[model samples]
Target: MEMRAKKSSRSSTSNTSGSTTTTAVERKEIERRRRQQMKSLCAKLASLIPKEHYSSKDAMTQLGSLDEAATYIKRLKERVEELRHKSASARLLAAGSGTRRGGGGGGASTSSAATTTASGGAGSSEEAGRREDDMPPAVVEVRQHNDGSSLDVVLISSAARPFKLHEVVTVLEEEGAETVNANLSVAGTKIFYTIHCKVRTYVR
Candidate 1:
């Protein structure tokens, strides 16, 4: 009976030792897999960041890559806000134009009556002046993209002006702006142009 008990105790000790060894091996494997997953995730994150934001030597550490990604996200958020503000301003401008048209008819009629009463001999000059007043002035606005790789231009020009699309394109090309998209809309004798460009060089 004593020998049997000793054998049973020894067997149990060996079993416990074996189980501990197996558990240790399992833990090591789990840790290795976790590290591999983390490495893969870091690589994917680095891929999404722009190359320009990377290190000058191109040897980006994991922490450096993550930092660049954070900065890029910040810039994107700011760009979104800027675009929203521009959209709001455009809406307000449209509303104001509508209001002005509604209220300006009476004032314009009164002015015409006064002008006629003041002079009959200057009818041709008055008509010329009126035509000029009816036409909107030429407006050009150029904005750089947040990435510094592109430009957006909004141009409002009078239809009466001797403007040519090809000439404008040629000028932009000369200034190192490659036009990617060009849109034209006409409203009440005013020509609106929206041009999107990829810039190869700095344009003044």
Candidate 2:
């Protein structure tokens, strides 16, 4: 009876030991797989960033790629915001111009009609004036901000004319203005140009 009991006890101990060993091996394998997954993710992140942001030393670490990716994302966000602002400004200016042209047309027609009632001579003069106002060669308007730190140049020109944009840019460059952003749009036979410039740049 004593020998049978001892054998039973020994078998139980061996079984417990085997179970512990198997559990340890399984845990170790899981940890190794986790590390491999982390390394693969890091490599993928590094690949997404520009090569200029990475160097020989940056590739060796686990967190280096993450940092570079974060910085690149930040710059992209800033660029997007800048473009949004420029687009908004362009739209506002265009809208304002359209409103002015509409209002001017309304006023001019009323005034011309009143003048037409005065005399035959006045009617002929009104026709001449209408022709002159209908087709202006070009109009350039420079508007400076109240703070004097920046300015916007608006140019409206006939598409058929020889008004080159580069000439305006050259003039701005010579006048100590740094061109920040520019937009061009065409409407019918006319071209609209809006250039934003910095006022406090190097003057030479």
Candidate 3:
């Protein structure tokens, strides 16, 4: 009986030792896997950062620590935001400049057209009388289709109190032209009118 009891105790001790060894091995494996995952994540982060942010020596050495990498990433984000703001501001300035240039050109063209119309056939005296009467002359351009069935008209004039659009419509109706589409815009004191019409031709 004593011998049997001793044998049983020895077996129990052996089992306990084996369990301890297995646990130790498991812990070591877990630690190794954790280290491998950390290295992989660091490599991915380093790839995202631009080379210019780091010194030439540091680029070759790679980022020394996680803290340094994080700081560099923060700086890169700030720089990108600054560049985006500058780009947006540049676009807005360009758009404003274009608008001003277009407005100036429109004013210049209106002045030139008025001068030409006044000097062309009215003579200096009649032009002076028209100016004295404060009657702003209208500029009209007409284009007819080859079939004489359609016309496109553009009218540019000053915005008088009564507005001459009604008279223009009435005249078009009397000339056997039916208005199809019209677009009107006012820039400063000048009014731009575009009209499309269909006209009937009477065959004699």
Winner by lDDT: 2
Model 2, 127-157: lDDT tens digits are 8567646766567677778765788888787
The residue pairs that clash in candidate 2, if any, are none
Most accurate candidate by TM-score: 2
TM-score of each: 0.49, 0.50, 0.44
Instruction: Candidate 3: list runs displaced more than 4 Å.
Output: 47-52, 55-63, 103-204
Q: Which stretches of candidate 1 lie over 4 Å from their true place?
A: 55-59, 102-204
List the global CA lDDT of all models.
0.69, 0.71, 0.64
- lDDT by residue (119-199, candidate 1, tens digit) is 663676568568857767566667877786777867776666423565566666756678899999998877788888887
lDDT value, candidate 3, whole model? 0.64
lDDT of 3 by residue, 79-165 (tens): 764554344334433433343335536646755666777555347546644663674555566666766567776776655422345
RMSD of 1: 15.0
